[model samples]
Structures are given as C-alpha cells and as structure tokens.
Target: MYPTEESDPFCLSAASATRLLTDAPWRRFASMGDSLAAGTGDPSPGYANLGWPDRLAGTLRRVRPDLAYLNAAKIGATTAKTLANQVGPVLEFGPDLIHISCGANDIWRPDPDLAEIGWNLRRIFERAAETGAQLTTFTLGSAFVVPGFPDWHDRVRALNDITRELAATHAAVLVDMWSHPVNSRPNLLSADRVHFSTSGQAVMASELVKGLVDVLRAHPVTSDRAPE
Candidate 1:
C-alpha cells in the first residue's frame, strides 16, 4: 500500500506496483514545457534527443504496446511561451496522460517575476486540466548544483512552491524532485550543469514512472476512447 497523507504529506512515495501501468487507461501521452521535456542533454547519434519524457513513453509502450506519444516541448522555452504555444497542440492531441516541465529558464533571468511565473503556470495547468488528462509536473532540484546560478536558488525554491501549490489545486501528479536522491549528485547533470545527463534522465524517468503509476492506481480511468 502507498503511504497515507499522514506518513507522506509531501506525496513523495515510491510506487511499487509496476503492474498498475499495464492496467491504467492511458493510450495517448503528450508532453509540454521546456528544454528539459525536450530531452536536451540526453542526446543520441541518429535519433532526436531522448529526454525523460521519451524514456517514460518507452516504458509506457511496454505496458500498452500501441501507445501514441507526442512531445511538443522545445529548448529554451519559458513558461509564458509554453502556456501559449504548447497548449493548443496538446489539446489537439487529446492525450489521456500529459507531462509538463517549465519555468527553470524564467527563474534564471535577471529580475525574475515570481508572480508572473505562477500565473503562467496556473494558466497552463488549468488549460491542460480542461483536456481531462492526468497531468504530471515536478519541483526543480536545488539550483545550487547548477554552476554560475547560486543567486537563483531562492527563485527556484519559490517556483517549486508555486508548482506544489498548483499541483494540489489542479489535482495533478507532483514529483518531488527536491527530495529525490539524484538531486544532489553532480554527475547526473550534463556538461551545461543545467540539464540532466543520460544516466540522470534515466533516473528521473524511473522515479517519474513510479509517480505516474501511483496516480493511475489511485484514479483509474474508465473510458474507452481511442487515441486520435
């Protein structure tokens, strides 16, 4: 059994039921947000960047052989642009499962606006929820790990707090990246010291899949709509 709210108020429980993915009613998966979702650091020689979302999709494919996946994320995307550009395409895809990761870029900018970031994120979450998809997002790990961004640590924390609040308000799955063991490991980061390395991506995908499975088990879908 998963930990109760009393035991895990942060909702950082690790999922043990791998079979839940097979049983969940997720046929179409869509991803939005920024470069992290775009799979920037984990590059392949021939194929496109296989980021954590792509890795998660591959795992989902194992359970549902016919799953359709679409990633509309781009490198260097801000929360505002993501809210504007990615929402329409995601809604068009009509995915039953969606992942969104953004705002890190905005937080690093000079004179970062926490209120504006929160507003844009709320809009994105609200719009995504309208599609009736099970949405998932994460709190950024400590920005102290990122070289040359020591001053932005507080901003990252603020954004993470907004993300956590929005996740609860919107009933979306939240991955507590701040508490994850990989958060402190420097090797998990790519040369840029911002994005995750291939191994780091794998670790993130592993943890994220667990969260997704937990959400599915708690709120099993009962629809029969096919992927469009």
Candidate 2:
C-alpha cells in the first residue's frame, strides 16, 4: 500500500542524502513521527494551515535555505506505528537531519512502557545512524488533560521519561514539550481539547523550533568532508 515516492506515501531522503555526499549544504534534514510534529488539525483562521513542521521548516529555510527538509508525520500515530510505517521512508530519503515527535496515542492506552518506546526509538535511531542523519525528537505534551483526559498529565510524564532516555541513547537532541507550563492551561487546546488549534500549534511550533535551533547552534555541523 505504501510505496516509495515522487509523490508516494514514503518520501525517502536517499537522493538528498546522496546529494550531501557531493558536498551540498542543503542535503540534510528529515522529520518523522506523529501529529504534534505533523501539526494535526492545525488551526489557522479556521484550522487550516500552520503546523509545527511547516513553521519549523519556514524558520529553518530562512536561517539555512540549503537544508533539504522532509516531514513524514501522521496524525494519531504512536511511536510504534511511526516506526512500523515511517521508518521505510526515512531509509529511502536518508537525509542528514531527523526530527521525531510521537507517542501521544500511547497515553490513551491503559498501560504504556517507556522501554518499549525506547525499543521503537532505537529502530529509528539505528536507521538514522545508518544514513548519517542527526536525529532530534520532542516529548509530546499532555493532550489527555484537555477534557476527557483526567490522567493526561501523568501519562505524558511517563512517556516523556522514556523518550528522554531514548534520546540519550541515540544521541538525539531532546525537545521536552511536556515541561512547558502552558499545557496546564485549557486555552492551548482545541474544542476537542486534545488537539491544538492553529494558534496553539504556532506556539508549540515556536517552542519546538527553539530547542532545535539551540541544538543546531550548539553543535553546528562541521564535517565538510562528505562521508564516503
């Protein structure tokens, strides 16, 4: 069902990764995971545009237009589901940078395991390493707290722990979205209270991009010597 693409389901970064092999500065960057990164149901004027990745990509292009950015995020995707499907696309694209924001669905499940989340992450990290992409990830905020989710705060915490440990192991730059205090407020949520409205997505996108900028700046890419 999911074939590789010119406009197919899985947009591989292989050509971009290869272009990097030729010393192109823009031959880098890929994002994969769930809705937060996808900016699912982003509200812009009427819940239309302005997802985090779009905003993040805008900022990135402004700062470094050379970057080859690809976002493969799906709404309602768990970390496991992301790996199951999205990983194939990353393998194809093989860009030099990767961003991950996932695991929100697990919050709704009765019990979730951080280590299993870690396992899913390892699969992603290993794949990135294979392609020489520097991976980055974000801990999803507490979506459950919106209305029906009396347990959201706690579930998000548990998941963030797993995500952090996974990042450490994979050497990913961590974006801790859960730690944001605004999540405690109801305005950050849509009428469903689970998803962010367009304005909310903009805020979250700004938050995530800040972390990404910090990391990219702190550890500026220096190896001009393209890998063989």
Candidate 3:
C-alpha cells in the first residue's frame, strides 16, 4: 500500500500485478545503473570480468558462490535511461536485491527539472519494493572530472543528495562514492579524466561490495550470510 496522490488505490495496476509481487529470497538479484556500473572504458580485464556487483557477489559467494545475479547497466546512462533499461528487466527478474547507480549523466545535461531524476529513482524503488525486494543505491563519483562536461560537478552533487535523502526515506542502503580515493585517487581513473581504468573500477567494486554487504545484513535471507 504505497501512499500516492492518485485518487484511488496507490497500488500498482492489475496489469502490473504479476510483475510486482514476488516471493523470494531473491538470489537472482539484478544490478542497474550507468557506465561506472558497466565498467565502461575500464582499460583492464579486472573490471570487465569483476565489477563491484560481481565483487560483492564473490565475497558473498565465498559462502554461497552459486548465488545468481545479473548486471543490466549500460554506458553513458542517466536516471531516465536507467529507468528505460532497468524497469522491464527488473520487473521480469523480480530480483531479491537490486543495486542502482545513475543520475550523473543527467547532471551532465543540466536539466532544469531536477525533480525528474528524483521522481524516476523513487519510481524504480517504489516499484521494486512492491515485491518486497531489498534495494541499494550508489552516489556515483564526481561529474566534474567527466572530461567534456565541466558544469556537471555541482549538478552531480545535487543528484547525489537527492538519492541519499530518498534512500533514508525508503530504508534503502546507500553507497557514497562521490568522495575519497574514488574522487582523490589519481590511479583509479583513466587519462581521459572521466572513465575509470581497471584498477579504479576495482575500487568501485569494493565500495559496491560494502553496500551489498550492508543490504544482505539487513535482509539476511540468503544462505551466504547465515549465522557465522
């Protein structure tokens, strides 16, 4: 019963019912977001083979290696694009857990309607929550260094704040990557000053792992994190 302004039921439409309600331990989790998530431009095999979600899965797999997961990230994506790519697959997967990192590209575009980004993310989370799936979101690294887009740094900060605030509202775990070695560590990025090199992506994967660990701790349904 998600509260909504719509006059009638705030619940999903009947057409969406099958996709909305899920029974889980969502071992078949799905990952969503942008290039950083896709590890785009990562000039190393490590990121290509093992991005953050994969790293998170591996650490958890240390106990339950067979756990099923999927990454639906795309290069150069924003929240709007993320919704496009993520909504259908997410509904189809009905994943027990979901991790999202987007909105940086949106900031790059300098859209006047910042609310649209927030609304879109909330929609994604609200829809997924219908199935009682656990959710996690990432505050991506800085946008200033994204090469061609210089005006985006402040916008990215705005987007990150919105995402973190929403996470608190919806009880979702959050990964904050806009600062620290990800932002400060020169070795973590490519010469383009925007995309990550392999090692840099690995660092991202580590942060992502921490967020997933937090989510798993909260949900505690999977066997990997059983009383140990």
lDDT of each model, Cα atoms only? Answer: 0.74, 0.64, 0.62
For model 3 the local lDDT of residue 6 reads: 23
Candidate 1 whole-model C-alpha lDDT, 0 to 1? 0.74
* Decoy 3 TM-score against native: 0.73
Which candidate number has the best TM-score?
1
| Clashes, model 2 | 11
TM-score of 2: 0.73
Clashes of 3: 2
Show pairs that collide, candidate 1: none
TM-score of each: 0.82, 0.73, 0.73
Report the C-alpha lDDT of model 2 over 1-228, residue by residue, as the tens digit.
212223321122324323223322335567788877676753434232566667656655544556667778888888789989998887787677777778777667766776777678677677776776666777776544634667767777777887788788777777676756646544557667677666556566555555555565666656464354
Worst 10-residue lDDT window for candidate 3 reads 2-11
Report RMSD (Å) for each prediction in the order shown.
7.1, 9.9, 13.3
Query: Tens-digit lDDT track for model 3 on 14-132?
Result: 22321222212446667788876565544553234445566555544444445677788888877788887777887687677777777767777644468898898887777767777
